[model samples]
Target: MTTSPESSGGATQSHKPACPTAEMGRWPASWEQEMQSTVNYLWHTDDLLGQGATASVYKARNKKSGELVAVKVFNTASYLRPREVQVREFEVLRKLNHQNIIKLFAVEEMGGSRQKVLVMEYCASGSLMSVLEGPENAFGLPEDEFLVVLRCVVAGMNHLRENGIVHRDIKPGNIMRLVGEEGQSIYKLTDFGAARELDDDEKFVSVYGTEEYLHPDMYERAVLRKPQQKAFGVAVDLWSIGVTLYHAATGSLPFVPFGGPRRNKEIMYRITTEKPAGAIAGTQRLENGPLEWSYTLPVTCQLSMGLQSQLVPILANILEVEQAKCWGFDQFFAETSDILQRVVVHVFSLPQAVVHHVYIHAHNTIAIFLEAVYKQTNVAPQHQEYLFEGHLCVLEPSLSAQHIAHTTASSPLTLFSMVSETPKGLAFRDPALDIPKFVPKVDLQADYNTAKGVLGAGYQALRLAQALLAGQELMLRGLHWFVFSNMAGVTEIQELKRAAELRSKLRTLAEVLSRCSRNITETKMTLSNLSSELMKNRDQVHEDRSIQQIQCCLDKMYLIYKQFKKSRMRPGLGYNEEQIHKLDKVNFSHLAKRLLQVFQEERVQKYQASLVTHGKRMRVVHETRNHLRLVGCSVAACNTEAQGAQESLSKILDWLSHQLLQDRTKGAQASPPPTAPYPSPALKDLVLHMQELCKEMKVLASDLQDNNRVIEGLSRVPSAPDI
Candidate 1:
């Protein structure tokens, strides 16, 4: 089954052609004739575009439609089982329908020798590899153009997932770009020749496709006679996308080994099992010399810390060694979408000047409000008394005013007991000084009945309660002010301008609360509904028949007055006031017992629910905090590296300046005449050094800018939430 190079075509026999060339290879006469006939059917012989390993692509006009198309004619003689491969690829292509995937028109068969031609949409820009390897190839593509290409690749992979297909052969060469009307480029995924249609029982048997682009799972799968139980699906496409992105960004493959024939195998093994080597890892110093240089590193280290923090979880999900822990596309997409949206909001909010001002103002207002509330409602009894000392007093009962006044001038013991034993004994003491001592002796009935004590004590309690309520109202107002500040400071100007909208929302909430409060009587009726609902379930606390019986007994006594009035006609049923009061006391006691039971049950349930929710939120906050820590650490590292670079660049500049000055001084000393014909060699060297220093300064400035961008990106990550 193995066809040697000589027998097939000996394509490499000639000085290797930049592209496939028929003149450089030898083919069987019959095979050549079959290819020629197929080409003629698809296109004019003069319009033969190019040739690949086993096919010749040609520009052809469809005879029926008169529309131009690209035809791929496969040489059956070169394929191991050409018919099967072609059918498989055709089946896969026909099922795929996406804007980014190339469209398949029709399949044409040559009558003799079983030659087949695939007709596809014509791509004027040809293949990405061809473009990249061309004479005018540039080092770096524009960011927009790169993103366009990336989007196409992702879109095509998404389509594959939709159709349950895997491309197996994804490479730059297989991708095509077409220029749009406005000079925009549109990329399309083509060549499904090596793709597989996955099924439950079936598994890929062979390790096929280009080595550089192969997934690690493929090699493992090939080593085993039976495929791994866990199949590599869409994640494999994601790996390819990662590699493609790295290539586009850096203009080279991420991992290229530096050794002999075994190097490729080593590199592949490392990719499958180990972390990437020689990644940038920020910056470091040598143990010995002043050696420093900026160079491309593995993406494992080269990726910005902010990006690394994002990628770790993604990689954990995508490249999970454990199948159980791995996230499917749906879960991955949902989590990623949430995180990305949060990150966008955070980044945009960071640089707004109003945000800081609002935050400080809100904090200050909250502190002041809390202090006022604490002072008002948290007053001790002693503090309250001290506040109303001279103005207020509790009413009490006792003797006549003259005796009371005399007793008030002395201490309590001497006042009450002494005055009762000898009423005139304390009369010499000043009345006002001992007033408190004598106040307790007066009968409360007489003292409170008088206008002064009633007005003073009652007024004090009312004023204290009013003040507490006012403090609470001020705290509520402060909340409204803080919310206003938040709305005003939003970085999105249009959103900030929607303060009126927020105020309207607040007004709506107020209206709703007002309506709910007004309908409290109706809402109270629902409390019975709640009780009934609770009673219906056997597991509920109120469900016991004994409890229901007790409730009925209590209900009868609850309406004792009504019952007593109605019982007038029925003499035996009527109860005396003493008996009625006794029933009332029993009813109150039963209600208290029921309330205690309900409160205990509710307390347990509330605690358990609170604990569960608290744990969940704590875990989320912990994860967010860790992510923020990583971001902060990365930013700090970037700043350190930048500082180091700046120092180095500064030292170099200072040295250059000093050397130039020294050279100028030497030149002036060597030249005796004030006006010399020409400057000395030292002076000329200084000029050259100055030019070199300027170039280095420009380079350093660019590096500094990149470092600043990285730092800015890191700073945008949110700080950890307070515990």
Candidate 2:
């Protein structure tokens, strides 16, 4: 035998044999030896285990500990840049620390080739897709066991959502089960290759995911009719969960039929536009029917029939074709929790279990429900008393009068007795003028006008002032509205002022309340900081033997606690005992008072502004009308002059309009047209213009009358406004 030059490290090195065996006969003796040498080289160098288009993975043992590790080696020369992958993978893995998630251990580079390797926690059980499709498939797991597996998946996904991460690609291939005891398994989610982190105010984008698990919005592109669409965040993960659960429960994907990739798109369309024929039918076949999908599946799997039913209605609310109907995270969380609770109860049938689930889920849903309730209940705190008290007053102001009469007829605060042994006053006859007996007729128009006038500008101003005073009341109310409305909490006073004309006054109220909320928030933050500082200085405090120093600290603590209590107290307008009791039943008085005060302050400021700016113009119109009448001008002639004058006055108004436009424009060069400066046409000018127009027509009429044919022609001329 002759040695091949490439063979090394004490391995067999043969070039050729005198008589070749069948295995060696097909190739040249030297080539066969080289092939063996290449295999030995790979075994020794640990450079390759599996190879792909851009990269290869190797099974390697740590040189120091001899522990087995999977190293993903990437070709830097290829399209997949190693640095980019390293950065993205690191960023993603650092934020995600779920048990179900694969852990990234370390990254290293080979010195000679500049080749990179990423070491990751290896799963011995392998990918979910392989297990499900292979000999050790979990497709036939017992119903209880299946549900347990499903729950693990859901818990992992829920953990992801809690941390604001979305595993966009949720499929069997990405999930791995870690075997525990007696074939029991805990599912681990792997492959963050397609994961995306949700921003504080972002919705889901990219519409990218596995075809089987794609949501209707992702594949079919139907207008997302759910409120969640507005800010499609973690809910996309939920949709994927639905697909996963459907597959787990039915042993087949709900949307995709028994066909290849070509049919997948069509199946998605059907799923989005048409309902699954019997998505829930098999659910009843389980040993325990219709498992609680919410708690069981991964964030992606919980999207089963039960969830769809609950979510569709909610999505309709959130993705309401009308944006207003769309629900925000708060609304979505609330509806989700409610449905989850109902489903849990429906499946488990045990109150204790249901309560436990409820408690576990409460943290997820409470703030949202509280916000919804707050939004629904938010009213002007000042007007709260008025709302309840005024209703009573409207119905019966005579209660106060009755008390006064009773007091006068007997001792103070006591009612008069009918059978008293007192002599009759004078002749005990009814007087001719029985003033108290007269009844006033109800005047509907007057009453409405009075109510409107009373609630005008002044009411708005009062409300604004009250909002400033009771900070927490405004903050809580605003928070409620923000949750319900999904608008940014107010940052400015102008936003509240502008809210006056919109149909939803809640938005405006929320804005004002938000402004005041800062005070309460800052106070709490200060208290927390102080307490933390004190705790840090615990040794110093103890070391101080001076009683005065300890007393000072105690005083500070007491003051903070008192402030906290005061901030937490619900503010309300004080009503009489009877009024308070009556209002308490309706729960309207507190809100009414707050609302009234806000409206009153706004109204007063507006009314004052209008008086200062527009009053003179109104007076001019009145004076003009009077002057036209005094001049004996016909209504038509006066009206024409008034119209001409009003139009001509635009020249004078231009300056004011330009100034206003400049104010609005800020740094911009262009100016808007002036309209405010041209006062409205006086009534006198209108009348005068009308008279002049009438005179011109009369002269033409007379000329036509003298000529019969001309008169007929003149009659045909269209009539103009009297001027």
Candidate 3:
């Protein structure tokens, strides 16, 4: 049946009425009144929807519901058609309830003529054939539109196969398109007039399908009227689906012999039956010209290669003339299901017309899609904001690519590559360095407060570490002066040699402190940028998992603070030697007096005053610890490294007190020096201990540098969205 170009339901329409009128052969004039009175359905006689060989469809309205429906009225000749065929269509439609299949409303009878009419759900967008006939779609349907058609048809056919039925006629004309409430295009299979119960492996002798889409075996006996023994199985529908898919993809039949498929049926059948393996299509321009063959879709096709790679294999397997070679409905359904589960998204970065076609599974989240987009455009994931149908595409685990594709597949998703602003106190260098600027902000205020507390504690620990580093350097400088400036108050030859050895030891310790200081400076610079980066992008963490991660980081920071406090060296830069004196056989009276005189000297007193200033400076730095703002796991790492530096400083102070300084508080005056050679057994033991501390400090500096490298690596980690 044919219907209005603007309004197509069960059938299509044209200028003249497709049904039998008074001029041809009309039913009674009162039949319309009888139909309205008996069935409560008013048929618009002027609005002919479509006309087929035995029926005419019209636009009709139900009086009780006031809902528009398509009315398929069988002509007088249809009454003489097979009773089994008529009953089968009604039964099939009544049992079917799928979104991809046309819906049947009611079967009403006309009182005057006693004629039956089918009322089905009306589709305003008409048939797919009409859409493909449009000038813009002359080449083929657009890729998205083609995918919709392909998926819907496969779903409808799969539903039929599940119910042990086969739609002998599958074509674009038998499929209808409707605009959904959300403006999404939906395709539904209609006109199941040729459908019948036929399971796999079951055979039927009848041949009933459009010639262009018919299998060669069916074409031979049906069109040529040739004697044939082979019966058609359920696989016949696969042949029709292949033709429909090819037509929707390229706007032409896959096999067209010379003079077109309609005029040269014998040649078209030969072309389809004689195709070699892997051959996909055949074309001929003239009756006598050589036929051209193609193994894949032409370059003019709009579909992406990713889609064609999956779709073409299904076409090749099902287009086979031999039923044994053709795929079963299960394989066909599985292949189509895979295709439906994957979507090709066209992403266009704003201000540039170039489009990136990204392929992703329908189940993937927006975050995953953004990562793929970043790979294509080199835009940082955190700097990308995508808009689909004018709504921001945010990270939500429940929302997936399928949902977006369902709602807004007509237009490319617009990607706005946001330029991140520079964080305060940090100058921008390379754009690539700003990749991980987006850090998840703590959701709970209590957690945030706890984070700040940990940062304050860490800042205090770093200050203590710095103070210890300063003291260690001061002690090294003081020891250097004492060892080389003839202030040791020793006269023995062995004592002079021991002093030279001590001077060399002091130089080595000084070099270790220098390296440690460099490590501290570099770490501080790294933390400054890391803290600013985190503060600049305080995107809220909505997910419970992300919140837990933030809490875990805070807990680790508190642990590091505790460890730093526990490992802190005791204050005063001197140790109690009462235990050592009890064990020593020699008296230290002479050494103690010499140390006191040296400390009181003007040159040594200047170094002593500098030490007191450093102690006060540490106190002031600690007072301002709470004012410092540091965030992220990187700060926690800094605290850990500071703990190592403090240990190193403690070792340096221990060596200074053990090997060089005397306890001046033990003031027993003018006792004889040790009778044994200078730097007795205890002093030699202290020197060896100092050498070990130097080696440990080198390792500590190396570890601090390694930790700094770890923090730098964190800047490159992509910040995952809070889904």
Which of the numbered candidates is closest to the native, going by highest TM-score? 3
Per-candidate total of colliding backbone pairs: 9, 84, 13
TM-score of each: 0.37, 0.33, 0.52
For candidate 3, which ten residues in a row score worst on lDDT? Answer: 485-494
**Taking the tens digit of each residue's C-alpha lDDT, what string does model 1 give over 615-690?**
3322332333233334334434434554565566567667766776776677677875666544466756766776
Superposed model 1: Cα runs more than 4 Å off: 1-41, 44-54, 63-66, 77-79, 82-84, 134-140, 199-203, 220-234, 259-263, 276-328, 331-723
C-alpha-based local distance difference test score of model 1: 0.41
RMSD of each: 43.0, 33.9, 31.1
- 592 Cα displacement, candidate 2 (Å): 77
- Over 519-596, each residue of candidate 2 has an lDDT whose tens digit, in order, gives 433333433443343233333323433233323333343333333333334343234633533332223223333444
TM-score, model 2 to reference? 0.33
What are the lDDT scores of the predictions, listed in order? Answer: 0.41, 0.37, 0.57
